[model samples]
Target chain A: MQIDWFTFGAQIVNFLILIGLLKRFLYGPILDAMDRRQASIRDRIAEAESKQEEAEQEAEKYRSLQSAFEAHRAERMQAVEEDAEARRHELLARAREDVEYLEAQWREAIERDRADFLHTVSERAVTETIQLTRRVLDDLADVDLEDQLVTVFLGHLQNPEDALAKKLIDAFEDADAEVTIRSAYELSDDQRERLLEVLEKRAGHSLTLSTVTDRELGLGVEVQVANRTVGWTIDQYIEQLLDEMLRQLEADLDQRLTADVSATGSMASVRHR
Target chain B: MEISPDQIVYWEWRFVTVNATLVYSWVVIVLLGAGAWFITRNLTVGPDISRWQNGLEVLVGQILTQIETTGLRHPKRYLPFIGTLFIFIVTCNILAVVPGYVAPTASVTTPIALAMCVFVAVPVYGIMNRGLKAYFKRYIRPTPLMLPFTIIGEISRTVALGIRLFGNMMSGNLIVAILLSLAPLLFPVAMQAFGLLIGVIQAYVFAVLALVYIASGARAHQNNGEPAPGDAEPSSAV
Candidate 1:
């Protein structure tokens, strides 16, 4: 057996070249690509994580905003309810005032109508009584009541105790114009002279006297001085009696209305007097 | 039939001779170089790999793992030398099944040349790792009296490595050739199959032994102050 030095040397060189070629092409490139792929995977994972974090934050922000909106809505609802309540009370008060005013106006209108009716009745009754008195005196006495009224009026002028007559006399004394006496019948010359003497004596002054026949005076006499007239008539007594009766009726109506209002506790129950 | 390729001389000169061993060894080397260049030319660094590339990667990866399992770190550093040894021996032995092909490993010349490479590499690595003085100092460790025995052991193991491979390959070829003349049919075929198996085994054995030797020498300094087993145990009877 023999060894070939040159052949062994050549084999060693061939193996070394093979090693160089394998290292460069095979090991180096494969390892580098694997590293790059791994790096890319890691980057993708990191980016996904970041996106998830941002999404979570956005969700949290939306949640907080929703909570705030809900709270604001609740506050507005409460305010609206309070406003509605206040408006309801204001409307109620205004309605009550309107009711009370309308009730007062109604009561005043009722009282005015009652007063007008009572005045009409009382005036009619007084007129009828006066007419009856005048008729009865005319029918019972065959004497003229006009002459009698004239005589009585002359007699009152002579007496100092007659208040109406005294007032007339004073007026006559103060008169700058002529004094006139009007009656329902013509007076005789003797009666006229008598009336003139008594008036002058009571007055203690000289005065011009005039006489008039006024049938509208009925059984009354009127004496005038300086556009002033004083008269005594049955109509006056009828008016006084009517006034007293009206006062009594008004007091009775007021007491009944008070009692009815207290009993029913309703102002609507009041009726016309 | 020749038992050793070195006996078949093609030409002769004053101090240079051309023989079957030289020719076959060159042939294996050329095949290895051309194959490596072709396979690695379009090597991809991505997942979409060719079948041939896949095979090479698996082969290289297994070789690296085997060297690492021998307690050797940096398997890549020793891969070129050890891997080349495996490929050359395996190709030379298995190609013997061809009618005209004489396996280079069946010759004492080829085995001795490979063993001498290992022998030279062991000290070179030891000296590189532990420095020149420390590498030589390992022979007389624990006593000065062991120097002669250590030298003799080294020389004897180198000679044994060359003889071991040459003997196994030559004997298998010789037995099969003789059996071919005697029992021409079944036994020779069976023997050739067995020989193929033996050839692959020897390839593994030689590669592993080269790795062990280099690992021991290179890592001797870092063995926690313990001595390295510079002489590895025989992996096969041959």
Candidate 2:
């Protein structure tokens, strides 16, 4: 069990030298390679993080822009709707005005046609009433009717009012003024002389008188003293009755036209609404 | 087979004895150095690599992982010392299968030399990691009463590391020699194969103990930042 210090010393030196050689070649290269790999992996992770952040920012920006565009489109659509409504109102108002004008013209033409028809009817009615009266009078007349009318006229002149006497006296004062008498039938010479005396006595002046037959002065007589004349006849009585009837017919036509025009106007107003 | 390679002295020059231990240790060193040079000489920094290069890298990686897992924070600083001890011992034991070759680990001289390196390396790593004053101050920790026990524990463990490896490797050779004398045939061959297994086990045991001793000293003066060895690494990976 002897120990040799010399051999032990040499082995220690050999182990130390082997450590140095292995360290230089083997451990150094492997460790360096592992460290480089770790560094490259860290760089890649950092780049990926940066790219993710950028993509998020871009997405946010695009979302905001899209919402803004939608809002703008909605606003434009509302404006267009408002414009269309306004135009519709304006055109409708114009159409209503045209309708009102056409309604007024139609009423005017109706009124004119009604007036023309009324005029023609009134003229025919007046002529027919006058002819009917004339026929009735002709059927009922006697031989004394003419003389009776002349006598009544003479009686009026003999007992005239004061104003009538004054008018007769003024007419008699003219040197060219002559009293001319007309009758629907002929009278005798004596009757004429009698009528002249009566007139001179009633007027309180000397008067010249003339007599003639005028069938158009029907069933009556007319006298002319200078520019003044007085007479009575059946034709005048028939004409007065016809004028009253024509006036009533005109009033009735005016009422009917007024009702028709007002009713038409109400219908036109409803249409406009 | 010689039980202790030290008894076989190949040369004697003055008082410096060049025994079978020194000669065989040199042979194992040359083989290891040459093999290391050959594998590392054409290493690629890129992805494509030779199969031999891959095998060497796997071996180197495993050694570094063991040192780091034992609570040594800086594995590269300890790699030169720890990796060499493992490779040298394993190469010596594995080559013992050769017919006339003596394993250096079968001699007490070589294992003593390797254990002495671990003992000297402890203080060197502790002082370098923490300062001189802080490293020496750890000897008196718990109380000054622990100083002698701490010193004796350090020396006893170093001696145990060397003696344990020498005993295991030398006993394998002794068993094989005894079996060769009895049968000199099939039994000797089987014992020699069994000796190979014992040699690999002893090499692994020697390298792990050295790593633990070195890491314990290296981390002694450091702050309580060192994780537990199991928490730091998966033991099944290596």
Clashing pairs in 1: none
In candidate 2, which residue pairs get closer than 3 Å at backbone N, Cα or C atoms, i.e. clash?
none
Residue-level lDDT tens digits of model 1 in B124-148: 8778777998777777766779889
- Against the native complex, each candidate's DockQ, computed on alpha carbons, is 0.19, 0.44
The Cα error of candidate 2 at residue A31, in Å, is 2.8
Q: Give candidate 2's error at residue A144 in angstroms.
A: 76
Q: Model 2 compared with the native: what TM-score?
A: 0.53
Candidate 1 chain B lowest-lDDT run of ten: B223-232
Candidate 2, residues B45-149: lDDT per residue as tens digits? 555768877787788788878887787778878888878888888889988899888898888888988999989988888789887887777788757787897
**Runs of candidate 1 exceeding 4 Å displacement:** A26-273, B1-64, B73-76, B83-111, B162-200, B221-231, B234-238
Per-prediction backbone clash count: 0, 0
lDDT of 1 by residue, A87-109 (tens): 99889877776776577667766
TM-scores, one per candidate: 0.58, 0.53
